[model samples]
Target: MLEINGLVKHYGDFTLNCTMKVEPGRITGLVGENGAGKSTTFKAVLGLITYDAGDVTLLGKAPSELTEEEKQKIGVTLAESGFSGYLKVKDVVPVLAALYPAFDREKFLGLCRKFGIPMDKYIREFSTGMKAKLKVLAAVTHRAEFLLMDEPTTGLDVMAREGILDLFREYMEEDENRSILISSHISSDLEGLCDDIYMIHNGEIVFHEETDVLLNEYGLIKADEEQYRNLDKEYILRVRRESFGYSCLTDQKQYYLENYPDVVVEKGSLDEVITMIIGGEKL
Candidate 1:
């Protein structure tokens, strides 16, 4: 439902170049470190920040071309931007209801109650986790077909995060036309929820792959200098040097396991793949 092509943004010395797609009825994840270009890319897609070049199409229109009515149909959660500190949880309901024609007040309040958010208290007084939860609740309850969430689970504990993830899954189940694009540092959360994941670093897109291919086929080979040297470098995607040994990432896990029976080959996670790609050298 979303398409970005050769998107480029520049800020003094920093630059962001990204390309990807978000299909209907799937959760696509953008994972990166704190200073990575994840946030910048999202801003560009939403037209919150003007980019120097490229095209961003959301729901069949350029972000800047989306009318007020069109804009209301797309949900958004910005990390530190949302309701003012002066507003209480109850006060937000009316504001959102006025803004989004299809907003479901009952569903919004139900989500707040389910997440244990106080209705009468000022949002400023709420903890970080409560604020984060409020933003997510506001976005999903608007009846938006598309969702762009930046760090939706931040400041939440394990239980709260799980609850939020389950809510997202339920939202997707409601309609095959729905889709979500989420960026978070919590790789484990994405592993369970995302259909595909994209990795960005230093203002550029580095890798994009299906979640299952990453989890099931990708692997890591931990070997000493000598063993690392002996293996065929063609299969290595990235290699990081460590004090005791070298850690190599490879998509050919079965190939390595069968050919180099002596080396230690283990399944790799998203975090491991990112670490090796950003920190290691490519073949």
Candidate 2:
């Protein structure tokens, strides 16, 4: 449902060049460290910022050419959603509802109740988690087909975060045409939610793969110097040697397991894979 090709953005010292696609009924996770260009990419797609070069299409229309009605079909929740502190939840919800043609007030209120956000109080009186929930409630209440969420769970506690994730899952199940692009530093949030992941480093996409392929195809191996010397170099992506042994990141875990029966081969998580890719090992 969304496509970005040859996206290039430059700001003197920092440069971002990324290309990827997200199809309907899938959640794509945009992961990277601070200043890795995740926000820049999002802004370019939303037409909030102009890129140096590339094409961005959302729902078959270029973002730059989209009308206000077309733009209303997409919802966005940033790390900090700007809500006037003077407005009460009761007043804020309707103001947002008036902007979209398909705003569902009943559904919105239900979500607010489910999330335990106090509708009677002004936004300034709410905690960070409460305000975050309020912002998400506003975004989802309109029933937008596509969502661009930047750290939607940032200020939320464990329970609140889980609730928000469940809401996303429910929303996706409602229609096969709906899609979401979520950007977050919390790797665990995307582990089970995203169908595919794109890891950005140095303002470029270093890796983009199906989540299952990554979990099943790669692993971490720890071995003594002699065992390390015996390993085939082609399978290794990175290696770090300690005084007594080495820790290696490899794509062919099964091959390594079969050949080096004595070495320890442990399955790697998404976080570990990202770390290895961003932080090159010292040999």
Instruction: Write down the TM-score of every candidate.
Output: 0.97, 0.94
lDDT value, residue 247 of candidate 2:
79
Model 1 — which ten-residue stretch has the worst lDDT?
73-82
lDDT of each: 0.92, 0.86
Candidate 2: which pairs clash? Answer: none
State the lDDT of candidate 1 residue by residue for 197-257, as single tens digits.
9999998889999999999889999999899879998889998888868999999898999
Residue 34 accuracy (lDDT) in model 1: 87
The 10-residue segment of model 2 with minimum total lDDT is 274-283
Number of backbone-clashing residue pairs for each candidate, in the order shown: 0, 0
**Candidate 2 Cα deviation (angstroms), residue 240:** 2.6
Q: Candidate 1 — number of clashing residue pairs?
A: 0
